[model samples]
Target: MKILLLTLGLGLVCGLQGLDNSAKGSPKLDGKWFTVALASNVTSKIEEGGSLRIFVYNIRVYDGFLTADFFKRENGKCIPFSVTAITKEDGSNLVHYDGLNDFSLESFDDEYSIFMLYNIKDGEVTIWGELFGRTPDLPDEIKKKFEEICERFGIGKDQIRDLYNDDRCEKLR
Candidate 1:
């Protein structure tokens, strides 16, 4: 009798878990979130062996790491994922916040960058810029790695799509 009762309780627990998993509302990928290039990248037309090539040293460094972030939706949905994109102080991180999809990121303290982009969607905004100083919490190795990736991916002429949309397995708002 006790064994049967235990089995019944276990079944109920499993059912409840399943219900919880399926319970969801209008999940919006809206607003900003943190993301990384899925290994695919494009290059800017002007940067094809030009004077502005070396990002760490010379050249006006037009592009840097993109650290996306966000503000809450007008509907009061909490900002999705916000991770600092760690970039050089020479520019700002620009990103386009979308109602259906976006990225959230911030690099570090006393950090700044440059960006230029436009928004083509309703209830959405695009931001892109040259980034500056990164957070002290970040390590040089990680920052260097990010720089390498940025050099490969952040070129304006490069129109490569993400290798994996769920690359970071990020949580969307």
Candidate 2:
């Protein structure tokens, strides 16, 4: 009886260890993700400080492929675009969109995730990135992580606009 109880306890411990490992990894990108902040060619055009930019990304992963839908508000109009993507490699979190856009995983936790996108063309790299969250409002740690990434990418403080207070985007589809 003692040996049986010990064995069961060990199994439970092992199972919980596995669970913890999975839980700490990057948050899944599927479902509606609100943009916390964005640093890109688009955001750099915002001349007004208080003007908020609203964006949302919806991602669906299926059968070794991913489909992403992007919606953004600009000039009092909502623009939408869709692209199909596939994982770059096995066990990699990065996804390649439409063969030109590379959405590479930067960091993620339960509340938020960051993806750095590179638009490669003719030997030039245009860098774009977004800080996405499960909710509209995120904790400070997530914000700091985004700041760190922007700094690392040589995006000046003026270039990193805060879109965290922007309204959530309406569904595009």
* lDDT tens digits by residue: candidate 2, 18-113: 112223454555677777777764463333332223365676655555666776566756777666754432222333432254445567656776
Query: Model 1, which residues run further than 4 Å from truth?
Result: 1-96, 99-136, 155-173
What TM-score fits each model? Answer: 0.20, 0.64
**How displaced is residue 120 in candidate 1, in Å?**
7.1
lDDT of each: 0.27, 0.56
Q: Tens-digit lDDT track for model 1 on 30-130?
A: 22223222111213311223111112111121133333343232233333333333322322222323321122222222222212222224533222222
**The 10-residue segment with the lowest total lDDT in model 2:** 12-21
